[model samples]
Target chain A: MNKMTRQFEGYSFIGLWIIGFMAFSLGPLLFSLIISFFKWSLLDKPVFIGLKNYIDMFKLDPLFWKSLKVTFTYAVVSVPLGLIVSLLLAILLNLKLKGMGIFRTLFYLPSVITGVAAAVLWMWVLQPDFGILNYFLSFLGIQGPDWLGDPNWALTSLIMMSVWGSGGGIVIFLAGLQNIPQLLYDVSSIDGATKFRQFRAITIPMITPSIFFNLIMGVIGAFRTFTQGYVMTNGGPLNSTYFYALYIYNKAFQDLQMGYAAALSWILFIIIAVLTLLVFKTSSSWVYYETERKG
Target chain B: MNIFGKSVTYAFLIISSFVFIIPFIWMVSTSLKEPGAIFAFPPQWIPDPFLFQNYKSAWTIAPFQQFLENTVTIVVLTTIGTVISSSIVAFGFARLVFRGRNVWFAILLASMMIPYEVTIIPLYVEFKLLGWIDTLRCLIVPSFFGAAFNIFLLRQYFLTIPYDLDEAAIIDGCSTFQVYWRIMLPIVAPALVTVAIFQVMNAWTDFMGPLIFLNDQRNYTLTLGLNLFRNSYLTEWNNLMAIASLVTVVPLIIFFIGQKYLIGGIAASGIKG
Candidate 1:
């Protein structure tokens, strides 16, 4: 092929993506930033009111702070808790035995029933009066709290629900676990290390990359939490579950404060970006890559 | 491992798996119970007289048929667009030598990190300007543009193919497009299937996209339809479970059929990251 044809062929392959990136991804991103400066409800022409929306978010909107508190609290609690649960699940399921696949599948089944369906099912599961969780708790002579109804327990309930849906994390960790060389365990065993010692020395360090991956993703996912609060609590029990994303949704769709919502979303974007960068910065200390040789 | 250790491991696994799957069993049990029987003390594990009528009522009482049609339209079209467009773009990044190829690929990777919530409001406004609000096109059109994740996935798969294969194909007078369409696509079939399956699940379970763009009852996706049902029929536990099960089962069925590809995709995403 001539140079012209070769270049054309190459560009043709990527042309669709360039168009898509410009139109859908880049364009909307920049436009949302622009809209953050203007006071535009759907009906009105955008009026430039540059810093008011951002300033008001910080000073005037108490719900903005409230939503941030709720979301950060959820992320702080849920992310580590979810990491521990999923890692443990991965360890147990890593046993090289017959019928392990069935157990893995059963464990993963709940995550597939995600989004609205999962949210609705948990609403019943966390129902105050006749929920299966409370009913099951009764057998142990413990009274379960009114989970989604009480202000204190509502966020906790959502966190627990998130743990149950940590099947995706489990699968990821399992893959990471399997990647660990059996030779490491063999060497540790030969050195007369205890099982716990072997795990701490060999297992944990090896899976730190997966841990790091899940932690970053988990933080981002937790910050974007909306459907659970929207569907189950309606951000209620005195705005206890008023997540940041839910606040954004209500601002844009319910209150029709498009400009304010745009600003809220930018704040959220900055929070996530900063948090992700912080994690990436910290990853060098803990995350172990197999390719990196010890100096 | 010793017998005691083996037995303990088995016991722990069985117990945890039961705990994991119990809610699903509860959902099914609730869906089949008589409406009054749902709150039965000690919670009837199984319905004595199974109420199959709940499913019928959930389906009949709403415009579920229309909802299903709307969902199918969006899922099918988006899946096709995602598979074809993503792979073609991926082939370019993997094989075709071009100026700024690495830069473009880097830009694409960076774009993936931008959260969907950031651009959603502006996109909604853009769709409204195009008069696509309350329409399925708003949901479907975006997929025809290659998704970053899907393109990245297929690009990985394409790069794994030996370059000699492409060289031979080119020497045989196959054009770049022909090489991608014929040789490269088939070799990367697994990745294509993986992308298609992920898109189907994403489009199927997507609540926010439809919520933002689709306002008309006639254009409601299954996620929107189920949310509406939950709101209007707050007290109908049996019917609610039935409809929830109906919505949940489609993806469950799809997962079962595409279990290998789906799990492979998850593992690839984690490990590659």
Candidate 2:
């Protein structure tokens, strides 16, 4: 009887959490999937319309394609650029230097200011007129294009801001870099490997796991880019920054097209799911696991 | 390393640090400058008059005190709820040998990847049905259920504690709850603190949740208030900067003080994956 009571008590500890998961996470997910097949306008009764939302998203909606293009462009461009820049920063910081901790802290500072403040700060930084970026451009005897204001440059400006916050990636890469054994480098140097050769041969292969992790995360994160577009441009200057999440937000809240918005979000979920699966499928080709080899 | 290589590395680090640090310095400078001096060519690094009243003006322009109070209430409640609920669920997952535990744990891990956008529509409708719209409950209640990431983090920490300790406690007449509360909780206090910090930062800086769920100005969190303030006071650059700077102070202080745990948490999640 005591054992039975203890067992029941142990299981009951997870009861509230299970209830929450069902109501908030899983229930909502399944409900969204169902509502995507219906016309749910928040007031009117939801009418069943099977696969019409998906068909419209694929065949009829221009903004769907536009937003997808914007999201993909941002993701494809920013992820690689962010990866290289952060890895470079990590490599630089990995150099044995006094006060490297201070530099690391400074680099990591911007990522901590993530929401509206970061968005507002970036708006001023990338302001076309009387902005510091343009002010600095004048010294080069060149005219700076309107960054967030220009149709052609708006998305690019947001990508630049995204790169600025890759400081978190730097911290992650720094941790990965430190995990690499120093003996490997010493052996490479003894074998007359140049510094560049050592990096290409040693650093790149060893840190590929971190790279893979960051790549997957960056793609998911970039696809859902919202706050910056919502704040800085509002998908403006010809919808140049009409990202997928912004579109979903507008459709659901601003336009009251909750059913269609639900459909769009499900499509995004599938896209990320497929992309992540593809990365995992291909990870075996490039991502080196030290344990796999040793074991 | 060679002397030439070392100098090049130092030079790169110093220049990059300046690049990273300049925007913040500029923010503080702009917050203290008069409106007329803000757009001055070859911008003044320092305000001539140092108008500190911009913060006061910024405060009065918005119901910032109310926003702060709302944010504090939300952060404190969410943090406590997250810590308590996540620790409980994590203990069950880590210590108990229940049927279908692995399947449930896997489902929990998979839920982390489902974007908030996928669930926002129904979640909004659900909250509306519950009459939680425009209230703090929409934000705080969901947090009490335990986040997947925090649960996962704490579970990993809990798994490191020896099962022998639980057996010993059981032999000493402690119930399962006692083993969890009196024994495991104190042992995993560091992990609990880590979860609390992450939850506080998350609740404090959360923008999308408040934007979606909140309708009334009185119910706005600091992030929403700052965004609304920016929209209404587009030309008031000094005041905008002042408010933005003010909104950043809590996260900045937390980041500075608990950077080790913060970075360690990230590394743990990233590398273990």
Candidate 3:
């Protein structure tokens, strides 16, 4: 084939993506940024009010601040908790033992049951009186908190739910663990390195990239938390669970503040971008790339 | 490892596994309980009557059949669209050396980092303007354009295949399109399946899309239908559990069936470039 036709075929192969990217991703991205400066409520004409939406968000909107606080708190607590729990689960499952496959599958079962179903399941499990969690707590003579119902425990309850879904992360971390060369551990054992010492020296460094990967993904997932808040709490019990995404949903859909919601989403975008970049910036210090080390 | 240490590990594994598995068991057991028996003290691990009738009631009480039809429609179409389009796009990136290929691929990668919330509002407006809202087209059409992650994944898989095969096909007069359609696609069948399975799970579980796009009750997907069921049957614990169990079990079954590919996709995405 001539170079011209070859080029045409190449472009044709990727043509759908180009159109989709422009229409779905790039175009809307720019549009969202533009509308963030306007004051449209979807029913009226948009009036460009540059920086006012942002200004209002920072200074005037109490729910904006509340949403930010709630989102950040959840991200701060859940990301690390998820990381540690999943990492430990990965390590445990990584041990070559009989029936490990069943245990691994059992651990991962919860993650597949996502969205409204997971929320509903947790709601029943954490029900104040008849829920199994509280029912089990009674056996120990310790009263379980009114888990999704109480303001103090609503966020905590959600955090606990996050742990149950750590099986997804466990699978990723298990893959990372298995990627480590057995020779490293074999050599360390011969050199009289304690198991803890070898793990600290070798295992930790080898999986740092996976840890870094999970951290960024976790941050993004944490900030975009919506379904649980929407279904389970409806951002209620005094808005304790009013996740930022839910707040955006309410503003855009319920309040019809499309412009304001656009601005809010930009703030969320900036926060995620900055956080991910910061992780990337610091990753060089701790995230050990085997290829980089060799080079 | 010492026998004592092995026993401790076994104990820990058993306890943790119980914590994970108990929710599922609780859901099923609760689904079978009579409504009055749901609040029985010390929570019945086994329902007294085993009221499987609740499942029938739950299905009949809502438009669950309609919901299932809608969900299956969206899932099947989106999976087909995503697999075909993403693999073609990925084939171009993996082979076909064109000008600005690297830059375009980089842009695609960067685009994946942009949160869905960033584009959702404007897309909502655009879809509304196009009269796509309140319709399943809004949910299914854009997927035919190719997703960044799936494109990236299939591209990686494509790159792993030897160039000799493509060359061999081309030397025998297979056009680029023919090579892509007949030869390269079959080689990357496993990756295509991975993408298709992930897309199915994604389209099935997706709540926000159907929530924002569809307003008509008849148009609601399973997730939205499940939410509506919860709202209307707020106090009917047995019925609610029955419906939730039904909603949750589909994905559970999918995971069990596609366990290898699902885990492989997750691991491959996590640790690979």
The complex in candidate 2 yields a DockQ of 0.68
Candidate 2 C-alpha lDDT tens digits along B1-273: 789988988898889888888888878899999989998988998899999999998898889999999999999999999999999999999998766678878988888888888998899999999999999999999888889999999888888888999999989999888999999999989888889899888899998999999989999899999989888935488899999999899999998888888777766564732
Estimate candidate 3's alpha-carbon lDDT, on a 0 to 1 scale.
0.91
Stretches > 4 Å off in candidate 2:
A1-7, B233-235, B270-273
C-alpha TM-score for every candidate = 0.98, 0.97, 0.98
Interface root-mean-square deviation of model 1 in angstroms is: 1.6
Per-residue CA lDDT of candidate 1, range A59-144, in tens? 99999999999999999999999999899988988988878899889988988988999999999998978999999899899999
Clash pairs, model 1 backbone: none
**Complex DockQ, candidate 1:** 0.70
Q: Tens digit of lDDT per residue, candidate 3, span A180-256? A: 99999999999999999988999899999889988999999999999999999999899999999999999999999
What's model 2's overall lDDT? 0.89
What lDDT is reached at residue B115 by model 1?
A: 83
lDDT of 1 at A80: 96
The candidate scoring highest on lDDT is 3
Q: What is the C-alpha lDDT of each candidate?
A: 0.89, 0.89, 0.91
- Report the lDDT tens digits of candidate 3 across residue range B88-110: 99999999987778888999998
Worst 10 residues of 2 chain A by lDDT: A1-10
lDDT of 2 at A96: 90
